[model samples]
Target: MSNLLKILLIEDDAIEVMKLNRAITSLELKHQIIEANNGEEALEILKKKEILPDIILLDLNMPKINGIEFLGILKEDDTLKYIPTIILTTSNNQKDLLSCYKIGVAGYVLKPLKYEEYVSKIESLLSYWSINELIKV
Candidate 1:
């Protein structure tokens, strides 16, 4: 692998995960996608890794730990702080949007309910990251 295409997906929904995986594969990104059901699980994955991901596609709602709280903790840690986190969630609340930005999320992408829209959004995100040269594996 080129180390330029590693993505960590912190999502609780299995179906959404599958859709995302298919989208990334279709893009021919040469990427590795890692899944975490919640913030806590995601943190453990980060701890076990020597190098952080190029990007994180995070969901807001989860069972054990919510995305807002997770972002709070992630932004505080020096080692994990630099990894860019993009909120890929279903929330459209002004408060949630404001709060996420306040915590320093790189981008906020609303979840697309429709299949085609979902694929489009994911591709755009991957393209943006690739163009920016942000992937560090």
Candidate 2:
């Protein structure tokens, strides 16, 4: 059976955030998404540990602690390291992609220019994860 996902989206851009929400709403998916404007804010949210997210969608660029650096810190933690983190960024830089993989990111997806394409990608990504067995702890 497919599970309802609790998603954490760590993104700095307001438009990007809106677009993700739009996609989810238009697609009629019932997954819950929690927003964090940057890596720092995301860390704060995670530190509470009251309710851990099923998966994390991270952005490469931000004000403080970019995605790669944030990933490093998260991997060092015993509990946080297990949550699936997908790089959801506009960066198509080879180095960034390689770095994310080296640091153990679950997936790396580039944000498409077209809204329709972006929606399609989001749907597929969410669909796969919702049905996949995710580590709750």
- What lDDT does the true structure give each of the candidates? 0.86, 0.96
Error of 1 at 48 (Å): 2.2
Residue-level lDDT tens digits of model 1 in 1-137: 13455788999999889989888777776777888888999999998878568889899988888999999999888878888999998999989999999999999999878988988898888877866756343
Clashes of 1: 0
- Model 1 residue 14 CA deviation in Å: 0.3
Lowest-sum lDDT 10-residue window in model 2: 1-10
Pairs in steric clash, model 1: none
TM-score of predicted model 1? Answer: 0.91
Candidate 2: clashing residue pairs, number: 0
Each model's number of backbone clashes? Answer: 0, 0
lDDT of 2 by residue, 13-110 (tens): 99999999999999998889999999999999999999889999999999889999999999999999999999999999999999999999999999
Off by over 4 Å in 2: none
Q: Which stretch of 10 consecutive residues in model 1 shows the poorest summed lDDT?
A: 128-137
